[model samples]
Target: MWIEGAKQAGVEAHPWDNLAEEPLPTSVEIEGTTVPVKWLPKPELGESGGDLRNVVFVYESAEPHLRLRWQWQARGDFGPVEHRITIENLGGQEVWLLMVDSLRLDWKVTPTQNLRNVYVEKGADSPSAEGTHLETVSDGYNWKGKSSTYAHPVKDEKREIIPAEIVCDSNGNGWYAGVEFSGRTRISLERNGTSLKSVLGLDPEPGPFKTRLGPGETFETPTVFLGAFRGGPDGAGNQLRPWVRAVLGNPVTWKDPQYPLMVNNSWGSGMQVDEPLALKMIGESKELGLEMFHVDAGWFRGVGDWYSEPKKFPHGLAFIADAAHREGLRFGIWTDWTQAALDTESGALNVRDPKVSDWLVTDLKPDWKPEDFKGQTIDIGVPEAHDWAAKEVKRIVEDYHLDMLEHDGYLVAQGCVQTDHPHGPPNRSTMRVIHDWASDFVLASNSTDVSYHAVRAYYDIYEKTRREHPGLLFEICNDGSRMVDFGSAAHGDYFSITDTYDPLSNRRAFYDTSHLLPAAMLESYVEKWPVPKPENFLYMLRSGMMGWITIMTDTTAWTPEQHEAARKAFELYKAQLRPFIRDAQMFHISARPDGVHWDGLEYWDATRGKGVVYAFRGSIPDEAGHHFILAGLQANKHYRLHFEDGSQPDHEVSGSELLGQGLSVRLWNPLSSELVFLDEVAARK
Candidate 1:
């Protein structure tokens, strides 16, 4: 497939055989006959113009067995090209799709021997050492590990793997690719002489079941994005970032106050939040200049039960929402809408009750009793189930006067084979239901439809609710950062990076996540547990300022000085960071912290001609200070620098000097941080 935007970016294609291997680019079996597919150029183009264009190519078997539509889309003049494959069963017989690669391409760029591949290592669940680690691809170092085992029995026994985004960069230019799926994805780059071949697609671990497509049935593959950059890794990141934002749609596109400064009552009160405590937090949050107060978990009676806990909120949930509204703050509540606690009596409403059983997608173990189930998964594919969920959401928002709903749960719904379900039987893929619902919802609301299966349900729920309750904000938190992908961002207003309180982890997450997500849609929170000292607390607070800031600590427990400091910190973030975070581009300056080095990132909005650099020194010993060139600034304009930590005197430097000669700073103390603000100085008369 040819991408016009990519060609405009000086990229050229090579005539290399893309299907000369043993495992075909796409394999399908119909009537016990395997067919070889060949790509044929289509007459018409897909979407075009506005920094993005799509060119589709069709692949069909020599015999009339199957057809695959490859839609290759390009973003911006030099941005990435994302490709998604759609397989359609052309014959009347049922077809079994064995494999379909999301990306398969060969290209020849400006030749250079200094090229190196880049990947990231996502750490385990442990708090102390958990972080996203970047590494260069080298020989004998397979990022996905030697064995491709899928879903091993032992959770911690899996080999170390990297994230989906991969980059092959020379000193001057680079090539980047990323699989958009949130689940297991494989990306590989191979060099043969001066040419490069890249392969990326779903890495479906060893599984028994195969996708079955009947006559005229189609299956769409997860998208794989590929692009080339003129600069190094940063340039590659820049190329991918906008494409992702365009695909996901910006937070501002959905609601006002695009990047909200939220105070969440999660870590502060845990699941024991009461009306009094919630009201108190709302007041404190308002005083701290927080725009939203989110009551996370425990607000409802149970997982599936949307009503407020009578003992905890005797006056009902509306009381808390009313209090927040009176304080001039938006009220938000959290729920795991996908699952119901098996232990609660309400679980019967989702599992045992005949009227609702068809509404559930929970797959029981062989011969297991319903009472033995730990959690009941709701089958949104069922029309009744979908309507019930929408009603509950509307009920909560209307009754509580809520402005936001934080949807927290798993991503993919387990396949339901029950024939009684509305969307069931042979095609158990929940993706179909999601697509149908989303299409209908978007049409009903008169909104443009962005076809992303993973977030379709989320988009439907959010759009349907917001249609009635205008200005409703939706947050997607899939048990931490597991589902932090374009699909989630497509519907969610903002995403919580993780639920952990570890300051270091949150800081490192901010650095890595910023590479793919815009700062406005990425949120970081200061943890309440194991509270840090005043300076460290400030560091934690500052770390979160790189994106949307959320404070999860109990204000009542803080001393008068701490409370005052928090208020000051919130004010500082609002004054220094909020103005730019919504539109500012992020540039990483330091490496991910290993506890021995200073870590930092920069947020610069070239239009505003101002930015902020946030740097932190970990506990371990290394350097007393660090210096790095600031990015995204006007070279000829003079800039005024202000220090938040008072470690440096106010100074003036030209943007050329800041970008070329670099800006220097010293923290002096370990476990400390500093924020450097840079604004273009007014031209002298």
Candidate 2:
């Protein structure tokens, strides 16, 4: 079917005989044999919801006692369409299934169309040197990008991505697709002469990925979304961000005006935080107009114990929660809920426990000891462990009086050495495990299955948790930004976009991730960074303030001037920036921030006829000015510019001038910044 537009980026029409060999898109392996399916033209129709419609095509293989179904969904009135494959074992015998891809497409583009592939990487652990990538898809081009909860690239190799890609011509009029599963997933694009081929689904490598489908059981591939768009990468993102919010995002969260809150977290002192410090931060948070007081790592009794640290919080977490509430601030705490440690408390997940021993992905060394905030990962895919974790999550939220819960570290298993677990064990001889980045990455025959099961269980737990506590926000920090993808976007309230919290890192991470996600869902932690001047301090704060802001420092220690500056910044964010952040068209008006050049982001609300430009002057000497070409404006209209920092004189300019000549921002100081707010002259009807 055509994409209802010009024939630029989509599945172009081709002869039916061209796809004769692979007419049916679903395939599977049974008992170590690749079995091709024969699909019949019997179509079944159904309505899913007010906005979702589904079409199912039943296909069958020669193998008996098996049922295969391919389902395609049309969601919303706009944006991408979704598709997935499912196979069910109908008889009493168990069937082994393998290698099912969610979606695949072949597009016949014009020869030498000058296509370019645009994609972004996960800020896994920290933002890599090249967070956003655009490369040519010349003839004979072959490319692949993988994604999981986290990534640890080799010394020189392709890194993990945010699990999406856009391939368009110079005009950015092309198709984009992404996987919706947070487990080990992969996307591939290949160009050979006039043909463009791609695939999206669970990574079927790490080879011949296998899963067990028992009697009356079914296995489904991860769902994938595909769409065509114009206006290059930014154009594609503008459509994607809203579609994600309207479809995948939590409806309850969006109903509240204050969905994306401003928070203060106590990680500035590291593991040294206690009752006095938390209370102090709470008061500071209330004074500074921050909404939530989030207690990071140090507040937990131990990694897996999840209770309050008694000596540190003598009155318990509930007492601290009460203190924050009394000061009119919400409370949240961080927990590596699935990691097991050596804590010997009664209810602790001690690795030495007989029952707990079987739950871990791999047996721990006899003398193995967990790091300050790190521990051995448990396989939440295992049913017993899944139940335990789901209960533990509910308990933590209820007992701790949490308005939000942040799950950090390794929360699920992608690899395991246990033979009896649900996903079974990796092949011993071919299995390879890398112990780096304080986490274990397994690569083997069964690794994909391990992640598949674990991801499903993790989703179920969170889905239940959301139902139980309707407004409780979930922060998915699988080692901080490692899990930034559509899957996590649907499951969690926001993502901690990166571990590095400096101004450059925060802006760079946000710039890369916000391409395909709602700005409110891409969170950045405002950690303690070198701030020689109060202007620089606001610059650091506003770096993360573009999206979700979490102050991760000792606010009580700020100088009086800095405190007032921060207070004013917070007030400005709430009144002026928050609305655009939640609902606006964002454009990366400058190239990626290099720390040595001027960088800026434009958030324009065409409907509201107002927006703001977040401009930052980098560390370059004598180069303190830059012109940011604004976007999404009517060229014939006139606009009024208000410089909050008076970097330049407030003036009126025609939209053609602003969009063409650009918004000029000049900061005298090297590390200073400015917020240039703009509105159409015709704003008032």
Candidate 3:
């Protein structure tokens, strides 16, 4: 699997163009035999024109009937290149396809090589101490990372990363790669002698990885993207983020001016929302300038029952949607559509029902009872289960007249104990279950296989739903940040980045995740925190406003002054900050938020020739003012600064002075924030 690299100072330059390599960049194994393949170039490369290039390299093995289609393509002339392998079984007999790695690159380096391996963890349950990890990879280094529908990391275990890796020198000159499958996938980086090998694709763990390809059946590996870069992490991100927006992001969603609309959620009251509370919140949402009203985790008849509670809202959810639309706001509801319970209602999916019981991941205890909201996991890998879930989603959307649908909690299968399912049977001896956070999670030998089938089905369901309702937005919130990866980015509109909602935790999660995703797609739920003062409230509000923001609080309960301040803040976010937030290059201008010192984020849009700095002061009383250096500006340009809070007089300065001498921000109180915006000024004639 090793490929030669261009030698520079006895160390090879990492191959940036993986597709053009001789022989092939990947291979497939049949039974125990490794198939040999050579390139058969095609004459008519479809759509190989300006700003896009597409090519198919047909590879023929020794066997006449077996051939591989290596499709490599890119939407833009620059940025990363993506490719996937298709194993075709054209012969009459079926064959087992095993060990088809998506990408295998061997980077030769010196034994004394000095490089940093950087990756970020999914903020599954909450923000961990090591959200973004950067470590030195030396002569004897081996690192393996995994991603799935949900992230489960035990104590002292290396947390599950976002299925991507970056290996670069101190100068940030290196290559990065990631997988585009929302299933059980992995990336590994290992260094031995002069070989630093990386393999990314489907994870074949817990033993025998096998998928059958009958005659005329084709199996495609998960697509992976790889790119070489010269700048550091931020530099890598600047190039990667725009490419993702163009290639992976939905064009229909972006065409809406308020794509990442402001949201006011009803979770501040927890699961006790009634019709009166919902109507009240809808009124307050309009007065506060929020664009959407979200009803969370309540309003349902029962667990697994998708009907509105008759007592809570006698008129059903359609009535609530009509109210929000009357106020000119979008209405979204939360659902765990794949979860099943004991509800005996006519339309409810009861786990104890004879047919539904078969789809359950495991046999429930005789006396098992369902939580008020949480329920048993279903194996959507089964065709019957998949079809039922798909139909249910479309029905719910139409019945409720929903503008958006948010799926929370574990809605996908990561592990199962069913032998009769398409993922095949699990080794019952290896089957182990743990009850955590009010649900059972299975672990078996075929855990990866179970996830593979379920994720594909999940993608299929969403694709079909999108085709039917073009404007419907889908939110991927696996109990808050577990499903934050490239695959979900392609399928869903935005991600709820964390379960914790404190200002510090919100900033921490945003800091870690914004490195690998677009700022407009990362949702930070600003829950009701201790905002004892107006400035503290602004501080809390601005913390999550850096990305897609959702305020999960009762705006009706705010004092008059707080309400006035929030209205102004929301107006400012919509008019002055959102454009930069949506299309600017983000930088961590200060240290990560510790709530003890000053911290901030900088957004500079070179195309717009303007940007803003969101600065915050911490609890330390003595550190009133902090100096900050900025990025993504011209050194010789003159800039005009405007302070949104007027903490300081509006002024002008040279970009060199701002970048080198630093912008000074002074705050008289702790737990306060300021927004300082800057734009390019005309040079003196």
Candidate 4:
């Protein structure tokens, strides 16, 4: 509630009554240069003395749910900076932190101790090949491992941080960095040659670190940094000041890379397009402003069949490629490079074939039916295998003039299972087999406009793809949020718009996703599978804006209404792009277990001087009183309000009136609705 460090900085308490509507502040001045700070909440004050300086930033918003204060403090500077961040539970009930980032790249280390609580490996040769195991301290927490050296460079090796790039300006003058670590959820630092720009961070820690809470108990963790240079010491505390400001100011520039939107056709039917159908799909996609149209499975003949199934498509794969190109869209094709369907007439296994052993599964039972045959996986690690893949890929690229290569089912492998393959020894860890497989994939698929795939394991694969191919885009498919960890979202080029298994679920899935992921990573289907109602269409349109919103249906089947809806969704999504995707904080206001009642999420954009609060009824049971209270509204300015799905008509009010008196949104049997207010809404009197 009280900030002890600000007094040292010659600042005031900036009481709640006088606090700004935003959670973070804009424009903080260190030394002389005053850069913009995005959002500022009131700070929490604690006892300060004896070398410890404490500062807390509190965000109060009722739209999504309640008020939360993020506390950051500096204490030990035994050469390097050591800082601790505390997430105080201003709310009365218990909450889940869900995600936390705590890495600071500025601190150079001969070896570092990363915060990984669990480690699972298939065998000795796996990447989880560490000598030590994570020791459990409490039920949900484990002690940090002692710093250890690695045989080679590991990027986010523990799946703790997001994908971060070590980019040097054209002259290699500037270095922008970001990584996740313990205590602190994420730390991003931007340094241009000399002056250390502001550091930014976020704290989703529900309570104190290590100690899980019981209703009102708190959880906190410290994000530490150590370095040397112009701005000052790279101590944890010093590194924190700028980062907290960055989190608060909501800076637009992120050193981490951004990915693009892509439309895939795997979830639906096969892609051996029925001539008339393929042509129709391409035409509709171009009309809907589609970018890449990927033709999924059924193209190749053999499981390891590199050739087209001429029977399925009369003209062969080249026809589809030419059609996509003529339609003003890039042609993308799918490859099960690491798989041999085993059903293709000539798809039998042989020791001579590099992928043969990898595809053969002695693990299969004699009683197993044809469909029950445990699928065979290929060995992509073998040199000859790599060459085979390269030659096959080269043929497709050359013959079809393809713009992108979609690698799928490259996940399941058998040759490298337990037997000796062309690559190495037997009984290898699945992870290593996959990692090595990924390395070869890059070489095999890299010579194109985009090299994308849907992977299951190895988080660094996203970084590898982006690093090797700067302009490349990765379509991450990890079954909704299974592989959708903080590190993946932070570093991957793009999020898979939807789970491959369930394409229709994304409409509601988008709400839960908005808590952390960006809208640019979402995907949708424009054409009707079951025919999304107008309300359902608006739901997807509203939430999909957080990432890449794409249509995944049979593009050829979009009706007149669906076409218009797609256009509307895209336009609306682009309109909210600023706060929804770029440099904005996604606040989870409320929780809905049944997902039937109104669940809320708020987006604050310090750059645009605007904010958006979204609320939706997951599933309604009985008519219960559900109200959404808004807290970030500025005082003394007139604001307009309405629902995204047109459930609530336009209403006007002043910020001052809603400051202490938050907006209480009440709905009866509501399906999905969004309330939008202009920047003037924050100026309300």
TM-score of each candidate? 0.81, 0.95, 0.93, 0.53
Model 4, 279-393: lDDT tens digits are 6777776777666667665565555565666776679777887888787666666654544434535543323344454433223333322211123444443435444554554
lDDT of 2 at 61: 50
Q: For each candidate in turn, give its C-alpha RMSD to the true structure in angstroms.
A: 7.1, 3.0, 3.9, 18.7
User: What is the model-wide C-alpha lDDT for candidate 1?
Assistant: 0.61
Clashing residue pairs in all predictions, respectively, total 0, 2, 1, 81
Better of 2 and 3 by TM-score: 2
Candidate 4 steric clashes? 81
Writing each residue's lDDT as its tens digit, candidate 2 over 1-685 gives: 2243112223333221112122453545556676654544434422233323555667555454666777667565567777777877776766677677787777777785889998998887668788899999998889999998666655467778999998888765877899898989999999887688888889988766888887888888998887777788998898889889988899998886886899999998899889999988988999999999999998877767888888999999999999999998899999988888888987799888988989887777787788888888888988999999999899999999989999988787788888998775588999887775345567778888998899999999999999999999999887778777888788999999888889899999999999989999988998888899878998898899999999988887789999999999999999989999999999999998888889999999999999999999999889977889999998999999999988778899899998899988888888779999998997446
lDDT of each: 0.61, 0.83, 0.83, 0.40
lDDT of 3 at 102: 86
Q: What is the Cα-based lDDT of residue 639 in candidate 4?
A: 66
Error of 2 at 239 (Å): 0.2
Query: lDDT at 413 for candidate 2?
Result: 79
Off by over 4 Å in 2: 1-52, 61-63, 437-439, 683-685
Error at 607, model 2, angstroms? 0.7
